[model samples]
Target: MSCLFSPIKLREETLANRIVMSPMCQYMAKEDGFATGWHLVHLASRAVGGVGLVLVEATAVEPRGRISDGDLGLWSDNHIKPLERIVKAVHDLGGKIGIQLAHAGRKSESRAGIPVAPSPIPFDEGYRTPHELSEGEIQEIQERFAEAAQRALRAGFDVIEVHAAHGYLISEFLSPAANKRTDRYGGSTENRARFLRETINAVRSVWPKERPLFVRISASDYTLDCMTLEETLRLLGCLKSEAVDVWDISSGGIVPTGLQPVAIGAYPGYQIPYASRIKRELGLITMAVGLISSPELAEYTLQAGNADLIALGRELLRNPYWPLSAASALGEEIPWPKPYERAK
Candidate 1:
């Protein structure tokens, strides 16, 4: 029996398999940040195609924190309506789903407005210099994150994942190279981790205990004086105590370039080692992501005790039936849609 096809329970939700559809930005939302019919169909089709879990892309907790004008937002009640429909569609197909609550921070690409960050730094030429957020402003952002978690629950999500990775707001605060403030929000490691810790507590206060809540962190930031894998393990260990259900581990994303260092034209499972290390060191449930495109490779990672789950991003976007195909390739019998039974 392949563990890859086995069910795993997180809190009250039971995933049908280890395969998960990782959050990938659509950049298809309109100015209002509401989910369009395009968003509905895109996410629902993946569920129908047989992913155990479908995690929605990074949704901004505030308008100013958005990566682009096209990014989705869940900052207010108005944004919940359209997203509610999408969640329902996925659930109706018997697929579990989660929303990745996010704040882009310094990485707010500024499509129509000025970018904001922990400090005033430009990613590149013509990239807007970010306005450093003040203490009061930082608190407001934390409140927004809590509010967004409540909204996601009301919108019928089974799980919530705080996106603290990919050079986003939470990750920015944790990176000493980016946060040079002399205030309490910066200076020490504990101070740098303050925002994330507070935000997690705030979100947990509103999120149901029975439902799983996850935090995605860049496991190893390949930057000078940034949070490393050891630090990530320590953070995850603490978060696990705070009821964070799992840690979705990915790497890099501290600088202008994203996790390109780890994905440096690498083959499949390049980042699996990071997942393995974290899981072993922290003894925490982890979701392995990044360049895991092959069925054999994904299975190998699991069999080797690397990660509890496998999150597929671009590969699944390219082929929604990747899991179904994987099951077939592994000679495991996975039920196909009745309509596709003949094809199978």
Candidate 2:
């Protein structure tokens, strides 16, 4: 059997294969941040298409944390039922499902209210300067993350991934370029990592230890003043006690377009090296993502131990059934949905 088709267990959750549908924002939620039918169909299709694990998009932990007014949220109890529907649909289809809990912070484009960040810096000239988060407010945000994790557990998700990547709230704290605070939450790398460390601890308080917790991080900020691969390693080392089960590695987005790393899609498997190195050095499981589309490439990555799991974003969007086709291409006999078995 191809490595890609092999099952792997993380905590108590055992995925059918190494194929993961990386969370991609749909931007189709109701203004109140409720999941709509579009989200159910979007995520369920991938499960039906045989994705081993389907991850819901970056869901906002609070109203103002939304990337847009239409982003899904878990801030309120009302949001749970709609998300639970999606979870049930995916589980019934025999696929594991996860949700990426996020806070957009300075990157929030939602017209709800002012954005908040570790500093008052704007993401770019076009964006407004985000209000610097007070120490009290920072604690509140961490509580919000914990509250959201409780909602995720109530919704019955198999995994919960914290979105600390791509210049969002937690990412802002990690990047020196975005965080200019002199407080304990800034200055040294250990200081900057404090927010993330505490945030993960908060989530872990509510999220079950038996279930896995994943953290998505931008391994490199692609700018000298921001995080480098070595700095990222230090940051992860600081988080060692959190017991994060997997590091879903991706890079850049700490700075604006020109200042960030070149577009990740410029080369296939462009971000694999970051994941590979993190796994090798830190001895942590990682999910490699970014422009990894072909079955051959995904299979090679697993066979070579580059990453524990292969996460696909745009490729899954282009073909929800990419996993089904990929199994055929690699000569792995994965099961297809009974309705599609005739065609297979």
Best by TM-score, which number? 2
Off by over 4 Å in 2: 261-265
- How does residue 3 of candidate 2 score in lDDT? 90
Error of 1 at 189 (Å): 1.9
RMSD in Å for model 2: 1.2
- Candidate 2's TM-score: 0.98
Write model 1 residue lDDT over 244-263, tens digit each, in one string: 88889887677656533333
TM-score of 1: 0.94
Best by lDDT: 2
The residue-by-residue lDDT of candidate 2 on 205-260, one tens digit each, is: 88998999999999998876578889999999888864699899998887887756
Model 1: lDDT to the true structure: 0.84
lDDT of 2: 0.93
Structural similarity to truth (TM-score) of each candidate: 0.94, 0.98
